[model samples]
Target: MVRITNTIDIDASTQQVYAALRALDAYPTWLRHSTVYRGTKMRTPQSGKSLSYEDSTMVGRMRGEVVEDVPDHALQFHQRKPSGSLDALIRYEVSAAGTGTHLTRVGELTTHGMLHIVQPILLRMAAAESERTMKSLKAHVEGHPI
Candidate 1:
């Protein structure tokens, strides 16, 4: 498993930022116009809620789930290929920073079988992806002016 962390401070309250994160749909779509569908009955991103997504990107098809959700604090989501090729766990942490919100994202990805050979390259790619996602979130939360 490899880990990458990205942080950004948004000019919004922790609750607001957290709400936007939980909203999911508010975040701008990226990488092949992937659409996320929540398969759980709960409206809130509580634990055990699954988000299944099919992206024509690198992974092709993947299954995702919410492992943790703490209002105004943190949210953790996990995704992986059904064939056990690629696995990623994403966690977002939010805190109050000078009346604004400090958001941190931790991304961990593990590659298996044939993919394991290219894990280093994939790590770098995932790191760039993490940065892009965080920037998009910051921009979206800041009214698209950032």
Candidate 2:
């Protein structure tokens, strides 16, 4: 198991940040390695909803379920590979920071089979990608290009 956590302060209100997080369709624009959903479109973040999508950095198409959803507060997703070789949980928490919003992202990944041999490298990559994504999210919310 590996865990990666990142936090970023967005120069926007909590509502604005939350709205942006819920906009799954725009993920490919700022999120590194993200791709469009293939099965069903995610209109909004709601508990029990499932999304099937593919990411460039992932092994294959992944299916994720919304485990928890609190508007303007927190959102959590649990994803797993189709073959059950990999599983991950991603969580986003938002809070008021001065006049802006403080967003924290936490990711945990577990691997099986041959993936265990390179777990350390995968964890490092996840951390780096997460940092990049944070910068992009901040830039996007602040109306600038990353």
Candidate 3:
């Protein structure tokens, strides 16, 4: 298993940050190299219902499910191929910091079958991607040029 975490400061309110994170359509707007993110299923915000999205990236594409969402606080999910072989558990968190928000994203990837052969490389790539996305998200959500 490989795990990584990234954090960025957003000059926005917690609510605003949460809203951006909750909107599936806005993911690709901030996340670089993310070409697709369509919410096929979603639960009400109050119920903190699970949501599923299909994402396409330069490397490949996969389906991801939101497993946890705490308003103004955090969002967590598990991502995998449609075959359900490799898995990526991800979490996003927000905190009120002074007058802004501190956003954090954490992810763990586990491989099955022969995918383990490239686990190290994949982990490194994921870490780099996570950092890049967080920085872009911070700029985009904070109303800065991205």
Encode model 2's per-residue lDDT on 86-139: one tens digit a residue.
Answer: 788989999999999999999999999887887887787778777887888899
lDDT of 2: 0.77
- Candidate 1 residue lDDT tens string, 1-146: 88999999999999888987787544434211322221222234446545433323464656666678888999998878889999989999999999899999999888999989988887877787678767767777777754
TM-score of candidate 2 relative to the true fold: 0.84
Taking the tens digit of each residue's C-alpha lDDT, what string does model 3 give over 1-146?
A: 87798888889999998888788767756665532332233424445446777666543556777788899999888778766557889899899999999888989988877668878877777887788777777787877867
In terms of lDDT, model 3 sits at 0.76
Q: How much does candidate 3 score in TM-score?
A: 0.84
For model 3, the superposed segments whose C-alpha errors exceed 4 Å read: 34-49
Residue 81 accuracy (lDDT) in model 2: 75
C-alpha displacement of 14 in model 3, angstroms? 0.9
Model 1, 109: alpha-carbon shift in Å? Answer: 0.8
TM-scores of all candidate predictions against the true structure: 0.81, 0.84, 0.84
